[model samples]
Target: MKKIILGIILLFNFSLVAQNPILDIHTADFANIENAYYKDIDNFYNQFVGTWIYTDSVKIIRFKFVKKEMFYRQSIKSCYVDYLVGEMQYVENGVEKINSLINLNINHSEIYNYNLYSYGKTNKDWYPKCLECPDTIERLPMSYNEPTNDDAGLEAAFVMHRADENGVEKIKIQYIETIGAYGIKPDGSPSITTNFTIPYGDYILIKEN
Candidate 1:
């Protein structure tokens, strides 16, 4: 009777451990993954801290980089955002006024991942389908149009590319804007629209002190 009671107790303890083995393993795995993810974010932020400039014959854009506090996973983290405070200066009707603008430092890979996971399609196939279409459709360049209420339509996009010319680290910035007029139809849709992108200027910006 004593041997049987001891055997039953040992078997019960072994079963308890076997039943929840995954819980013990995942606790350690999650800790290591979280540490690596934050480390990568910190390294990426350190690479993008500086001031950049772009100019044209008549206009100029000075982009200043600054770190801002953001809430992530119930904790505060530092991230970079373009703060236009005291950086943008333009003349309007012979009066100079400061512009306030803030933009996120979005990565191209993030955009690609978003489209891939959300739509389950590559960038080439991510588009509206027509009623009558061929079996195989050639991919076209990606374009987006934003809705507006003003008479003069507006479209804007930003492109960033890296450059290493003569050992000087630089980034090429293309900020394109299109302005036009559109006629509305009876169904509250754009009937006839004419648009063209005015050439502002593209610049290769270097890190400034």
Candidate 2:
């Protein structure tokens, strides 16, 4: 009896995709600073500052006075948050949210305060705040064979999250009327009746507790 053993070696030649060396260097720089911030307690002084705005039909406004907080060089990309006291304000009208406070479709003053936390670097301006911004609103742009502003189309979209001290991560909900309910949260606001009901242009960033 002859015993013959056949050994096959399977080699996977990984094609090394040559990426730009400068890209790695840039990433490393940000990453190194981020790591240091996480480890140091004193580094938790910066606030995760962002903007919030709202609109009805007549007026479009921005939190023009939103303050910019100091961010540690090491905290550029880390998931760290430092609690700093802050407040937010807005104007409302005869809407359900603010009708009791005042009447008429005129803008009124409103404010909310919260502790600061850090998220990753966000775009300086998510949606430019322009009162004259066109009504180019759509969850997804209509293409060749897609529905565009039919009766059955996506309505209001909202991003919700709790801006806590440790870090902002409790909930993030986008309300599309086409999907479900059409009322504001318990905290007195307009019942997001329809997609169009949401003021165009101004992005609403709800900072949770």
Candidate 3:
């Protein structure tokens, strides 16, 4: 009728500019993916400042990280994703609230030696898989354990420095408790303490040599 009503108003302005996530930059969808996901989470906490340790049977905590910040996504369309949150102001209740809940999601692969490792999708319920496990969105030599007998359990106990089988410098000690079977010891061997009532969740990933 009049060029079909100007081609239906230019297809409704291209579907409202492809559902506006900051005018859709080729498809990050939402004002430049929350500033490219917090500039890769401030370069992954400035390469995780330094020091981190977590163990259990009662306690052992050391996380002395200093810099981390990102929390800007008030309603850029509200699909609920806009954070790079950090700044634990040093420990208070252990591992600075589990390393600010180790929530990362930006790993645009490039054979990284840590080139902004992990790109998108690591928000594993934000604490409470015993506080983020399977080391959610993993990369750097990740590890996890849980199994103190609902099917078998033991949760954790590590001291790896492997080489054995002939290269020998070995010093292994893995006893991940309670998600299933787990046991391995050789750090001066002879250990046996198994008991699990179930309610486990473990996480590990270390490679900062």
Best by lDDT: 1
Best by TM-score: 1
How much is the lDDT of residue 46 in candidate 2? Answer: 28
- Model 2, runs deviating above 4 Å: 1-57, 64-88, 92-118, 122-209
Q: Which of the two candidates, 2 or 3, achieves a greater lDDT against the reference?
A: 3
lDDT of 1 by residue, 61-137 (tens): 45454332221222232222211111223333444343332333433222221111111111222333322334553
lDDT of 3 by residue, 34-69 (tens): 333333422433344443444555444332232323
What are the models' TM-scores?
Answer: 0.36, 0.23, 0.21
**Better model by TM-score: candidate 1 vs candidate 3:** 1
Where's the lowest-lDDT run of ten residues in candidate 1? 113-122
Candidate 2 Cα deviation (angstroms), residue 57? 7.7
lDDT (CA) per prediction: 0.36, 0.27, 0.31
Better of 1 and 2 by TM-score: 1
RMSD of candidate 3 to the true fold?
A: 17.2
Q: Candidate 2 or 3, higher TM-score?
A: 2
Q: Model 3, residue 88: what's the lDDT?
A: 12
Where does candidate 2 have its weakest 10-residue lDDT segment? 138-147
TM-score of candidate 1 against the unseen true structure? 0.36
